[model samples]
Target: MKYPVTVYGDPLLRKKAKAIEKDHPKLDEIIENMWETMYYSDGVGLAAPQVGLSIRLFVIDASSGADEEPELEGFKKVFINPEIIETKGDEWTMNEGCLSLPEIREDVSRHDEVTIKYLDENFVEHTETYKGFAGRVIQHEYDHLEGILFVDYLSPLRKRLLKGKLIAISKGKVRPHYRIKVPK
Candidate 1:
């Protein structure tokens, strides 16, 4: 089932998520639901908090059902309790959007490469490095687990300019293509 994405202004998005145990119940089902919800929303990545859950779990499919990036083709995976071990490389700016913060895209600066340690859906541990679009997608989703939104990386002036739009989103004034759970 596709879960209603938690929208901006939800307090849950500000709280850091708890790491799930290796044998957490219904882990498989939750992962499957996340995939369904993400694909249904046309999102490249998604986090648990975005679905009203406070768990350190997320899914990413940088391919986005397209062949835009040959390197990202078939690059889909589930990250459970992920931790960034290292981030090395020049920072690059990319236009980023979030499922929670609809209709607000920003050029955010991020490292071009990242090395992360995380678990698969079955709790198998792995450490890997990613670059280019895949790295950007992973970093973006990983930030959600730490209660960091892409908007937070914007400059104060830029944020001030977007303050009204952000508030509108919080008040459920924005309309996204997919289902969202606006904060009450």
Candidate 2:
């Protein structure tokens, strides 16, 4: 079943997520549910906290947009307790949106490449480097585990301008196509 996405104002989104142990209960089932929720919401990436679980986990599937970025074909991955080892290359801007902050998209700047260490669904370790679109997506989702939001990267003036919209989202005044859990 698809979980209602935990929205922006939820305190869960502001807290650092916990790492998952190899023997975490129902691990496989959780991953499957996350994928279902992500696809159902038309999200390229979904972090555990976004699903009301404060765990260091996220999934990414960018293959749906492979036509524009051929390298993203089959770029599906499951990250458990991911650690970003290095972020290099010039910073670039990309218009990004999040399921947690529905209807809000902004230009966010992030590194062009990143090297990370993470365990896969089977608890197998893998260290990989990604660049361009894949790298940006990874960085975005990784930040969620750190209790950071993409809007935090915006300039002060921009943030002030968006304050009203942000509050509206928190108050559950927006109508996103997918289900969402607003802050109490």
Candidate 3:
């Protein structure tokens, strides 16, 4: 089932998520629901906090295209209690946005490549190396688990410029339209 995504400035978004202790009865169902919610919302990634859950879980599928492609495929992957064990290369700037902070996009500097160790939906441990846009998406979602937002990477001036919008979002003065369907 699709769930409501918490908007920016929600206090829950700032609280660090708690780690999932074990594979419990509803863990699989929760993860599945998260994936459905994410795809329904047209998001590349979504964290538990975004859905009002304070668990260290996030889902991502960064296999979308840059521009030219006519269609994008979902390579959905789940990360439960993920950690970036290593990073390499200089920071690269990419235009980034989030489901929590809607209608806002900014250029943020992030590591071009990263090696992350994480548990999958089945609770199996795995490690993977990612680069380019895929890597950036992973890092961004990872930050959500730690109570961090991409806007935090902005300079004081940039952040200040966006203050009004952020405040409006937090106060529910403005609502964002979530594109919930993916083109087949």
Q: lDDT of each model, Cα atoms only? A: 0.92, 0.95, 0.82
What TM-score do all the candidates reach, one by one?
0.96, 0.98, 0.89
For model 1, what is the C-alpha lDDT against the true structure? 0.92
**Which scores better on TM-score, 1 or 3?**
1
What digit string (tens of lDDT, one per residue) describes model 3 on residues 94-125?
A: 89988888788999999988999999877889
| Poorest 10 consecutive residues by lDDT, candidate 3 | 175-184
What is candidate 2's lDDT per residue for 143-183, written digit by digit as tens?
A: 99999999999999999999999999999999998999999
Model 3 whole-model lDDT (C-alpha atoms): 0.82
Mind giving the per-residue lDDT tens digits that candidate 1 earns over 1-184?
9999998899999999999997888888999999999999989899999999999999998876346668777889999999999998999998999999999999999999999999998789999999989999899999999999999999999999999998998898988888889899
